[model samples]
Target: MQNTSHLLMIRPVKFSFNEQTAVNNAFQQNDTNNNVAEMAAREFDAFAQKLQANGVDVTIVEDTPEPYTPDSIFPNNWISFHEDGNIILYPMFAVNRRAERKPHVLKAIEKKFRIQNKIDLTALEANHQFLEGTGSMVLDRDHKIAYACLSPRTHMSALNNFAEKTGFTTVAFHANDRNGLPIYHTNVMMCVADQFVVVCMESITDENEKKLVRDAIHKTDKSIILISFHQMEHFAGNMLQVQNNRGEKLLIMSTQAYESLTADQIKILENYNRIIHSSLNTIETNGGGSARCMLAEVFLPVQQTQ
Candidate 1:
C-alpha cells in the first residue's frame, strides 16, 4: 500500500534556484550551470521516460511561464493523493510555493481518479505554521502511521490537523544534519518502503526519539536499511519504493544517490526490489530535491468507464 504505479510530475518552465527554500534546506546550492532550465527539462523528460519504460504510469503536467514558480518541479510538497478517495492540499512555508497548487492540476487528474473530498490546509499558512505535504511527513500507509521531523517547514499544528482528519497516528522527532541544523524535510532523512525502510539514523539527535522511530519501524514489519550522514547528504535516504504495471517493486532514486549507497546496503535493498535510477544532477543542485520529490503518488481509485 505504500507504493503506487501512478505518479504525478510537473514539468519545470522556470526551474531555477529558489532562495526562499534555500534558507533552511541545506540540500540546495547556487546555480552554477548556465543552461539550468534546458538541462533540468531534459533531465525531467529522461527521468519520466525511464519510469515509463519500466511500466510506471506517469502523469506529466506542464508548468506555466507567466507566474514563474521556480520550485514547481517538486509537486509532491503541495499535494498528496490518497487511496481513500481524498486529495489533500498542504500549507507551504515559502510564499512562491503557494502558487504551485493549481485547481487545473486537480481537475486534470480527477478525469481518471475518483476523488470524494478535498482537505484544504492552506489556511494554516496565515498563522505562519506549515506542513509541506509528503515532504514534511513520510506516511506508512499500510500501518497508518506518520513519521515527521520538526523543522521550520514542518509544524506540529498542521501535522496534528492532518492526523486528526486522516486517522493516522504521529511519531514526531527532531532531526538535524551534520552541521547540527534542523533537517528541512523528513523525506530527505528517511523513506518508508513496503518491505523495508531506508533511513539515516544519525540524523536523529535525541536518543529517546531515535528509539521511538526505530521501534515504530520495527513494529511495522519492515527491514531496516540504515545509511550514514555522509550518504544522506548525497540524498541516499530520499529513495521511494513504487510498483510498476506488472506489480513488480522498484526502488527509485537519482544516480548520485544510488552511487552513494554501499555495496552491502545496495544488496540489501536489491533483495526487496529492483533498483531504478536516473541522472538528475542539474535538478538536484538547483531544485534541492531528487526522484522522490518529483513524484506524487496517485492512490485514488480509477473511475470506471462505460
Candidate 2:
C-alpha cells in the first residue's frame, strides 16, 4: 500500500528555532516571533484535528521538554514505521537532533502498533554519515523504489546501506536550491504519492539525472506535476498523500504551499484526491519543515484483540 491512514506525530514542548538544523536547512528562520512554541503547538493541534476529522488515524505523542530538542516536531527524520512490522531508526545529522531517539518514544508506539524488526542505523553517526530517514528519501513504496537527493545530511553510504537492507532500489541524484546550495533533505523538494509525484525539476541541476528520475517515476506509471523553484520554496513539493479510514485518498500540505500552487497544478492534483491543508506558518518558520515533515507514516499492523 502506498498511502497509509495511520500517522505518528510528536506534539512539541520546546518547539522553536533550531540553530543546529538552520546551518543547512535554508527554510528555517530565527526572527519568526517571541512566542514561537505556543503558536507552533496551536498549529500542530489544528493540523492533527483536521486530519483526524477527515478520518485519518493519528497517534499523538507528547515530546519531552528536558532534552531541549527544538526540532522534535519533525520526527520523520529519526524514525520510520514500515508495513512489514519493522521500525527503522536513522542517524540524524545535527548533534542535538540525535537526542530525539529516546527509548520511551518507541515504547509509546509499541502499545498500539506491533513492531517486528528494529533496524538501528544510528551507529553510522560515529562516522559522520547520516540518512535522516524519509526526509532524505522520498519513497515510492508500492514500486519498492527510493528517490534520494544527496547532501551533507544525506550521505551516499547511508543510502546504499538502506537500499541493501530494505531491498529498495535507489535512484540517487543531487539537488540544490535557487541559491545554488544543496537542499538539506529530499522531502523539501519532492514527494512521491501513489498515483503521481510532485517535484521541483529545476532543483535537479544535472540534466541526465533529472531525466533518470523522470524515467524512474514514469516507469512506475505515475504522473508528474513539475513544480517551480519558487513554488518549492513555499513547500509546494512537501505534500503527502494519505488514505482515510473510508478508503478515500487525500493530498495533504501546508496552507502556504496550497496557496502557492497554480490553478492548473491544483486541478491536476485534485483529479487524484481531495486536498487537505492547514495553517502552519509558525511551525514552518521555526522548524524549517511543513506538514509532511510533521507526519511519520505508521505502517505497522495494529495490535489485534485478545
TM-score of each model, paired residue for residue: 0.99, 0.99
Q: For residues 1-306, what per-residue lDDT tens digits would candidate 1 score against the true structure?
A: 889999999999889999989999999998878899999999999999999999999989999886779989999999999999999999999999999987778888988889999999999999998999999999999989999999999999999999999999999999999999999999998999998899999899899999999999999889888999998889898888999999999999999999999899889999999999999999999888898999999999998998
Backbone N/Cα/C clashes per model: 0, 0
The true-versus-predicted C-alpha distance at residue 296 of model 1, in Å, is 0.2
Compute the lDDT of residue 73 as modeled in candidate 2: 92
Cα displacement (Å) at residue 99, model 1:
0.2
Regions of model 1 farther than 4 Å from truth = none
1-306, model 2: which lDDT tens digit per residue? 899999989999988888889999999889647888889999999999999999999999999998888888999999999999999999999999999987788988899999999999999999999999989999999988999999999999999999999999999999999999999999989999989999999999999999999999999999999999999999998999999999999999999999999999999999999999999999988778999999999999999979
The global C-alpha lDDT for each of the candidates, from Candidate 1 onward, is 0.93, 0.94
